[model samples]
Target: MTRHARSERLLLCDELDRLGPDRPTLCEGWQTRDLAAHLLVRENRPDLSVGRFVPFLGGHLDREQRRIANGDYAAVVDRVRRGAPAWNPMSNAKVDEITNLIEFFVHHEDVRRAQAGWAPRELAPQLEGKLWSALRRSARLMFRKAPTGIVLIADGRGRYAAKLPDAHGTVVLRAPVGELVLYAYGRKGVARVGFEGDADDIAALQGAELGIS
Candidate 1:
């Protein structure tokens, strides 16, 4: 089977090259160059990648990211396009496919949807199914801190609920699985999802911090 994640990674790298380092992205405070550096660090630097979850290790990761970002922009993009080194787990096809499919897809949208005149890309049903499968394993964690119950409806597919133990009010978000994944990853303002619930609940959920680190 073709590795969709690999294709998305290359495509995103090309986009970074096309847009240049100064272009904005949906990732807070990250321009294209910063995003490229982040991808490189994520795939290559195991130590720094762990810092994504370990708070104390983050300062070093941030400094390294800055150093990478300050290097020649074209070279950075080329490195991202070339992907992780052979010894890195991410360089393994199976590992990259399972781990990076949703990652690259989301980051690709982060770049695409953050710019002017942006629109949703039409995705294949197979790709959508892959994304939904990944979301099933991850959605609850992403929305674990949500203020209210979250009912995610993958339009024409299925639903997944992320609810607090004593949660009362609920918010229903209906959208294609791809868009729902985006919302689950904290892209609320840009994700094309329909909200159904009490206005207060909706507001609170929308305003709350969502997504993994």
Candidate 2:
């Protein structure tokens, strides 16, 4: 697990290095270096005092996200927020670790796909569990939109299987574990995955409303 985290950080660092200082990235309006700076800030800023980190009241993170999603990522954020020496900073939020893990994992792909147009990076084997847990949960969240369930079959080398929580049938997706994992998160296109169940549901997951395309 530790190694996976370290490897993940290294991969992101490599992508950032490759992007250099003046290239536009997949993330809108933010340059590649700008994304790197944002990541560095997120990882390093975990040590701030409560007052500095969490705001008491306002529009909330959702509102903040809306503002930033269509606004300037660089203008509002400081690129290099220094953090205490703890390797990586963490949050006290209930789901902080899991949420950040997914954020980093998906965005790592986002950064790579957006800028270099490269294949997904190789992830640690342990990531299979975290990925399964995450995708399973996210599947439930996305289930309401579909009449059936989707079964995601990874390389099966990892602990994950072509799991379908509750549905009429199963849909199978197989590839290199890393690529399959990304595909399950709806990070990769539906065509990249081999489907084995309801075509409509599969198409829904791959639909424009879901935003994987």
Candidate 3:
């Protein structure tokens, strides 16, 4: 089986190199260099990455991220390209795939969509299936805070009830799996997904804070 996580990592690295460090990315306030440093911290520094979920440690994570971002830009990008080191749990192929697939895919789009003249890429069906499978496993938790019912349709893949019906009813989002993933990841402004349902419900879903932090 092909490993899309690895491929996305390399592609993101190439974009980082081509665009140089100062390029903008869809991650608000994060440039290419910062994004690269983020990937490195996520893969290599489990101790600090906890700050991503534990709010109190955020300052430490932020300081380390800035330190890495301020260093050699080329070196930072190269480290991301090289992926997690032997000591990092993400170094295992299966673990990396299970964890980094969506992480890299979202971040890759984060970098691409923030640029000028960028377009969504056509993804392989296998990769789309993998993403859909992953979505199926996590949609509820990801959409738990949605103020309205949520449904995601991945064209040929299938439909998923991302959130249970709420008083506002359900809103459906239609897109290719990759785009749906982007939308679910809270790249709402950049994600090329179409919405349908009662206008109010759709609006509520749109305004709702989404994605895991």
What's the TM-score of every candidate structure? 0.93, 0.57, 0.96
lDDT of 1 by residue, 143-213 (tens): 88888888888976788886753354899989999899999998988999999999988888877888985
Identify the runs in model 3 with alpha carbons over 4 angstroms from their true place: none
lDDT of each: 0.88, 0.50, 0.90
Roughly what TM-score does model 3 have, to 2 decimal places? Answer: 0.96
Q: What is the clash tally of candidate 1? A: 0
TM-score of 2: 0.57
Q: Rank order by lDDT, top first? A: 3, 1, 2
**Per-prediction tally of clashes:** 0, 0, 0
Where is the poorest 10-residue window by lDDT in model 2?
A: 76-85
Return whichever of 1 and 3 wins on TM-score: 3
Stretches > 4 Å off in candidate 2: 40-99, 120-124, 127-130, 142-147, 157-170, 211-213
- Candidate 2 residue lDDT tens string, 1-213: 243433454565565555555666555666655565555445553332232346763235334334343444343223222221344434333344455556566656766776544665555567866666666656545434433454555665543333353434445555655555555555554225565656765565555233222
